[model samples]
Target: MFYFFFAVAALITGYFVYGKIVESSFGVDTCRATPACRLADGVDYVKMNPKTIYMVQLLNIAGLGPIFGPILGALYGPAALVWIVLGSIFAGAVHDYFSGMMSVRYDGKSIPDAVGHNLGKFAKQFMNVFSVILLLLVGVVFILGPAKLLAVKIGFNLDKNMAVVVWTGIIFAYYFLATILPVDKIIGRLYPLFTACLLIMAFGLSTMLIVDGYTFFPNGVGLANVHPKGLPIWPLMFITIACGAISGFHATQSPMMARCIPDEKCGRPIFYGAMIGEGIIALVWATLGMTFYQTPEALQATLASGGPAAVVDQVATTLMGPIGGFLAIIGVIILPISSGDTAFRAARLIIADFSKVEQKSIAKRLLIAIPLFVIGFIITKTDFNIIWRYFGFANQTLATIVLWASAMYLVRHGKAHWIASVPATFMTAVCATYLCVAPEFPLHMSADYGYPIGIAVAAACFVWFMLAARNTPVEVDAVDSPGVIG
Candidate 1:
């Protein structure tokens, strides 16, 4: 419990202290006109209230990633808490802030464009495809995830499979509408209310934990691998706990809010602060997972029998009572649904930006969105577990790329590049090691081979960055040039 409180406090402090350093390095220019004001298309680039943008950004990047990820992450024991606090402060929030602010500097273009400016055209084009596929996966996963949970909730003598199908259609319908609608109409308006429910659920669970004196760590905060399967803590825990710590998916979502930010001044709170807020949500869920079962082994048993959704249902109802539990379940459902809608929306924007289709027209928006949803619907039929496993790897890989891109951005501007470069190097190792050793991959090598290779790969990448940094020309007027940086 003390550790949990300290972790939360550290996250809050990190937002003010480390977040400020990031904001300063990025050089948030309040006097400069934001994409929302400068490129007010009324569709995507509409000016929004800072507070609303903050809430929407939180919901956009969060989804069930923070909650579900941390629950699974708790299998690794108290090390999850250490990762959440440190990762959110140094890696995740910084990655998110730069993703959003870089978009603001680039006239609210999608992430591919932002990467293109710094990492060159090939990186931009690569990210364009990589980001779209990841967004589609997120949309489909979120759709199926909430649909199944809601199916259980609305049991009416309906076959569970049929109920899931019914809810899937309903969620996809909502995603379609949210994808095409004006920014302020659906996401901007509805997210704040949904975000409120999410916060209420998290805080309510947190309050009960404190009042009841639940023991978060039965032993001292030891970094032992308590995973029932003996999964090593190095890469698996890091990948499993992506959003709660640092998810690259958040980078894709950040630009969506970047277009809506009314001023540069709100960048830190909305982007960096949202990541910290998610870290808190993740901490609450991780605590519940660790304590509610009384042991990690028991938690693993429950997980095997019912999966993460079932765990969420059982925990909420058990701890919060019937009424509060129902609301808490609704909050859990809302988590993914809110993010699902935006995932599609972000996909549409990415397609439009790359395709050069002006999204101001409703016809053009649908042209981009219909094909995307069709693809998303097709993906829903695949094994959810397979997709999720791949999503975690792909998600972190994207984060690694974004971190490198951000590093390049910083290096070009002559600001401290280490902030982004260090995390990029670390995640590069994590992703590489996972690919080599994870059973899900084709190689499936032993950790003995994977560990050394991962470190070597990361070192090579760092060397490449050092060499490239010296050669790449610095943008003298990065703040003024929309053709390069704003």
Candidate 2:
């Protein structure tokens, strides 16, 4: 109980304190015209209230990250809570705020263009492909995850395969429509309600935890790792909880909300504050995870038997009872749908930006979206576990790039760069090492070997950054403008 309360309070407090420190460092200029004001096309760049944008940003970034990621990450025990609190405040929220503010400062450009502007033309070129692939992966994963959940909830009266197919088609159709629709029309209109339900679901679960005296961090709840496979804490745990703590996917989603923010001042609450909200949501979910099964061993075994969806079903029904169970199902269903639509939309904009195409008309939007959707739909047929493995690495890798780009932006524009650089350096190592040792990835090396390799890569990056910073003279003005078309 105390653990959950401290985390919640700390997240809220972080926003007022650290959030401002970040805002002041970013040099948020309230007078500067935002994309919504400077490039109002009434389609994607429509200006909305901070309140609405906050809700949209929250729903988009939070998605299954807080719920799914935390549940899986909690398999590591109490240590997971430490990462959720520290990483969210220090790393995750910081990443989101910088990315969103950078977008605002640069006419809400897709993160690729922002990367190019800071890291150089070559980096931008690489990120363009990288960002698109990541977004498509998110789209595919969200589609499959929620579809399966809802299909399971519907029962086995109908053919399970057919149920999955039906749900897939329904989800993809909505993704297509939402992708091409105007910013304020669908996502903006409906996300607030979804956010409401998501929050309620979080609070409801917490209520269950309290009533049940769930030992979130009691003496029995061991903080040490207890994974059945002995998945190393360094990389696997980091990968598992990417969303709640920090995720590169949020960088991609930020521009969607950035295009709607009314002012530079709105950036803090919409970007940073929303991340804090996600952190709180993550804490609640992680706490629920801590208390859900009798022990980490039981949780791991259950996860092995039934997978994450099964875990969700058992907990919702077991702890929350039937009514809470239904609402939990709704919240779970909404998680990916809200994020999935935006993922496809972000993918479209990323492609359009790369090709220098305007998105004011639905026809042009469809022209770009068809190929993307076709690819995403095909990916759904592959193994979910494989896609997720790639996603965890890719998500953090994207974040690493953005963090570097942010550091570069700060340097060029003459602000403190260490804030971004430090995290960037750490995430770079996490990605570099995870690939070398992770079972799903190609290397298949021992976990012991991966750590040294990770350390070397991080050192190499830090040295390279220092050398580059010293050699590369700082620029007076920012490279990217605030009115460039997507």
Candidate 3:
């Protein structure tokens, strides 16, 4: 109980202290015209209330990451809690703040464009493909979970597979409209309510757990490897907990809100604060996963038998009763739907930016979005485990690249680059290590070889960054202005 509350307090405190320092480093200029003000095309660039944007951005970057990922991460015991607190504050939030603010600074360019601006054209081109694929994966991943859940909850009485198909079609239709429509039309109007439900479910369950004395850390938190499979804590836990800690996927989502933020000052709360909020949710869920089950072995058994969704249902029903279970289901269903729509939307915008196509025309939007939806639908037929495994790796790899790019942005703009650079180095090692050891990767190496190789790769990259930083000239402008991506 004390540990859980302390972790929550740490995240909140991180937002006020470290979040403020990050905002200061970027030098937020309240007077500067944001993309929404300077480039209001009434389509993607329409400005809305900052509060609404905060909720929308929260749902956008969140999806099933904080909930599902942390539940899976809990197999590693309290070590997951430590990662959630430190990773969210130091890496995830910082990555998000820079990704969003950099887009705002660059006239609302996509993340690939922002990455390319700092990293190089090659990087820009690579990220263009990388981000689109990641978004599509997100769109597809979010769809399957919700579709399956809705099918079961509704009990259509049709063939179970058929019910899933019907729900998938319904979700796809919504994604189409949400992608092609203006930001305020589908996403902005609906997300706040959904976000409220999501928050309430998280906090409500947390409160009930506290009342039940279910979340007390009787073992007083240790670093023991508690996974039933005995998975190493180093990279596996990091990957499993990507969304709650740090995710490259958030970088893709940030640019969408970047185009809507009315002032530079909103970046901290909307981006960094949202991440901190996610961390708290993750902490609650991780704590629940740890304490709700009798033992790590039992949690693993429950997971293997029915998955996280089953665990969530049992917990909600047990603690909060029927109404709470219904609300929990609805909130969990909304999690991916809210994020899935924007994933497709972000993909459409990324493709438009890459192809130099204007988005003011509905036909033009369809030209990109149709193929994307078609591709996403086809991907749903593949193995979910394979897609999720690759998504986890790709997600972290993207975060690693974005952090390096963000570090480069600070290096050229002449702020405190270490804030980003340090995290960049750490994620680089994590991704490198995962690549070497993960079964999904072709290398199929053991942890013994992967660890040293990963550290060496990180060290090499750090040296490269240091050399580049020394040679790169500093700009150090006191004020930011709209700039061309080239």
Candidate 4:
């Protein structure tokens, strides 16, 4: 119980301290207008209140990733808490804040543009196609997650072809409509309501956890390796809790809000603050995962009997009774739907941005969106398990790239690059080692070879960055406004 409270306090404290340090280093200024104001298209770049923008950014990134990922990650033991608190604070929030602010600095272009400017043109091209594929995978997974949940809530046997098909159609229809509509009309309006559901669910469950006399982590924190079978803690745990800790996907989504924020000042609260909010939700779910079951082996056995989504239903129903269960159902259902549509929306904008195609016209939007949807829907018909596994490696790989890009932004401007550079290097090592060692990843090298190869590759990346990041005769001018960094 005390440990849970401490975890919450660390997240909040980290926001004020580490989050603010990130904001100051970026030199956020209120006097200047943002691209949302300077480049309003009445479509995606409409100015919104900070609260609404925060809600949109939060829901845009939250999805089923945090909940489902943490449930799976809880299989590792209380070590998940250590990762969630520290990773979210030092790595996740920094990754998210800089990504959002960088978009604002670059006039609300896609991430490829930002990466291109900092890394190189080739990196930009790779990121553009890579991000589109990643978002497509994310889009399909989110759609399938909710449709299954809807089937469960309706008490339908999902094994029946018609039940799964009908739910999929309903969710896919919503995703299509939400993708084409203006931001203010659909996402900006509906997202706040969805955010409210998520918060209420978190708060209610959190209160029950504390008020109902549940003791978590009774043996206390350690490198005890409490996983049912001794899964190495290094890369598996990091990959499992990707979104809650640090994710490349958030970098993609941050620009969507970057195109809506009216002033630079709100970037701190909206972008950095929203990530802190996500960390809190993740902590709650992780705590629930640790306590709601008896042991790691029992948890594994239960997972074998039923999946992560089923665990959410069982836990909520047991802990909160029927009413809490209903609210949890609503919250869980809203999460993936809100995130799924935006995944497609982000993909549309990325492709359009890559083509330099104007997006104001409904016809142009439809032209790009139709093909992507057809491809995504077809991909959804394959085995979801394989798709999700591949996504984790790709997801973290993108994060490593974004972090290095961020470090580049800091270095080119002659500011302290340590903040971004440190985490960037660490994640690079994590992802590289995971691919080599993790049996699921395509590389699949033995652990003995993987660790040395991981360190060597990461060190090589560091050297490459130091060579490439030499001060250009002219600064890249990452910030567009009069707000200049010395």
Candidate 5:
């Protein structure tokens, strides 16, 4: 029953959200020859074949978030998987693909820049402030979660501080390689190999579990033991879905990839297809979580050993022995590295956009990397699950705002009123109201600061949108601007 709804929801969302929103936004010639559309020659800017671009985008965007978010969602049983699948197709994929397309049309501008250009100066500045905060939280939380997970799996005796040091080193290595090495070589040679390994590990684990006669369905599947003081199932489902669906991180990744796509027509396949792939990854993880544990006690024990990563490792080992466990480590490593590379690149772009620093300079890149690593290192000691939840709320709120901005752009440029406004407005309202009303629900973590922050951001955006509508003149110049790919 749950899987039925899950498939239905994913298919519907793919058609409506991914098909319409992203495709319409970045269709052929939509980003041709504008100032925002300039393509640089080298790793970050070199144009690539559409198919290659699609593959690169998929590998980059499909990271640990999808796996962990869906696994967490499975805590509420298969009912949670339905929402995860639906939300990923509709909200998550659309957010990532359109956000990338929108950035491309704005000369490689980010979501914050788009807000400022389409809305007003205040909107841009407000978004920047919120974005930096959100990024800090996201960077720290994401880094820590995977690091801790790895530590537990390997039986590393390092404390949180030491674990952070090791994690930072790994991140730094990826960033260094990405920045210094040619992207084509990396993507052409390395990315495929990495992705192939990921697929092998993923399928190998699944097959092993099945062959071992592991129960395909969780036993005692009920939401009875969900944490009452924590955020409830429905709201947490929304938040978790946001990680898979519409992460703020995508705002950074999409534009970077857009600049590298060989032609304007490639945007749809590269951006939209990548997002769909990410949704599939999330679904896989959700399935794993469901099949692996049947009771709250089992889930807790797995968590105590580590977290979702450990649970995944345990399951793989249970099915395939030590070889599977080793493969799991490699698979886990790929996730953080993929996300970290994107994170570093995104942070560099954001910094370059806002500051006087030149992205071309090695010093400038290092300057940005150092602070980011430090922040990530410091926050490694904090509880990752809590931070991840907060990130979902804040990140999703940003996605809602981006969706509105995209709709406005389509209406103004393409004059697709019904197509543009209806879905966009619906998503905005659903996401906004969900965040705002969520705190009132009887759920664990309801009283957390993240929920209130999300509410405040949503409320402020509502007011900002209203005022901007009344006072500011809409600028459609960006619609024709060319974007830089990197």
Candidate 6:
């Protein structure tokens, strides 16, 4: 029954989200020739087919967060899978795709820039400040936690200091290559190979677990025991599924990819396809987490002792012996690096947009990278679980804001206003309430850190939106002038 629901939800949500991306990009003629839609000559603006773009976007968006978020979500047992899939399709994928298209329509601007244009200068500054702080927080949490887990698997002593040093070097290498090497050459060839490896490793591990007859839920466990917050599951469901639902990372990544899209038609596959890949990855991890650890207590124990990568490694070893363990380690190592690369690139783009720095300049890129590296290093000493929880809260808050902004853009463009606005408004309310009530919930991290940060972000978003509404509207006619996309 659990597996059935999981698989069904995955397929349905995957199709819906992917289809929305395609429809929004091509159906609305957002991809038509315009100055804002033109491709640049360099790494940030190279052209590519939809398929290649899809692969790059998939690899970039699907990261350690999906793996860990589901593991965390499984605290509510198999029931959590339902919300993970549904919310991901409606909230997560929509936010990512539309935000990307909105950025393209606004001259390849990011979420902050869009906010500034449609809202006001204050909204833009608020978003920029929050975004940078949130990015640093996310980057540090992602790099250090996963690096520590990977170190343990690879026999590197797994100390905090060593993990920071090693992952920082890895991030620097990724950025150096991405900035120096041609994106078309690298993403075209290297990404496919990387994706293949990931698929094979993930499939093999999942197949092995299923073959071993690992149970999805532990014996004697019931709904009452699974979620101590009681059976009215809406709030826990909303908070548990972070990136699988909506994330700030997408807001940054979509635009970074949008800048290079040669035509508007390509946006559907790149934006929506990337999200489907991310949803699938989440399903795989959620299934593994549920199957590997029979009980919520057992899963919590494993995570507490060594974090999620350790649990994943243990599951792999249980299924495939030494070879599976090796593959699991490799998979874990790749997850964070792939995400870190995306994170670094997105952070640089956001910085460039906010500061008006010339992205083409190597010196400017280095300047952007340096402070990010330093901040990432400084936060490595913090508790991984705490950081992860805080990031989830911050990300959800950002997602709510972005979704509202995207819906507003759709309305302004005279699209399906109600269709977009209803879901956007509902999700914002649900997520906001969840964050407010989360501190009293049964989840460990939620009560400790997640809910509080969520409340603060929600409050700030509310204020920002109110202020933005007061600003005089930017002339839509001027923005839509001949040869202009923004």
TM-score of each: 0.98, 0.96, 0.97, 0.96, 0.80, 0.83
| Tens digit per residue, CA lDDT, model 1, 27-145 | 87789898889889899999999999999998998888898899999999999999999999999999999999999999898888888888877888899999999999999889989
lDDT of 6 by residue, 1-486 (tens): 356345656656566665665365324564366323464757576666667777777777666777777777776776656666666666676777777777777777777887565445676778888877777776666566556665565435657667656765675566446643456766556666677767755777777766787665554324343743343455555555677656777787777677777777666567765676676667777777766777677778887887677777787777778876776656656666666666766777788888888766777778887777766677866777677766776777777667766655553454443434445555665566665565544543544355565456556655544454344243444233221112
Reference-based lDDT, residue 78, model 2: 73
Q: lDDT of each structure? A: 0.90, 0.85, 0.89, 0.84, 0.62, 0.65
Off by over 4 Å in 6: 5-27, 34-39, 156-164, 175-182, 185-189, 216-225, 228-237, 434-486
Candidate 3 lDDT by residue in tens digits, 310-335: 78777777878988877887888898
User: What is the lDDT, from 0 to 100, of the residue 467 in candidate 4?
Assistant: 69
Question: Which runs in model 4 stand beyond 4 Å of their true positions?
Answer: 155-161, 471-486
Off by over 4 Å in 3: 476-486
The most accurate candidate by TM-score is 1
Ranking by lDDT: 1, 3, 2, 4, 6, 5
Output the lDDT of residue 458, model 1.
97
Steric clash pairs (candidate 1):
479-486
Model 1, residue 446: distance off in Å is 0.5
lDDT of 4: 0.84
Q: Evaluate model 1: give its lDDT.
A: 0.90
Clashes of each: 1, 1, 0, 0, 18, 1
Q: Give per-residue CA lDDT, model 2, range 332-394, as digits (tens).
A: 889889989999999999899899999998889999999999999899999988898889899
Superposed by TM-score, candidate 3 places the C-alpha of residue 207 at a distance from the truth, in angstroms, of: 0.9
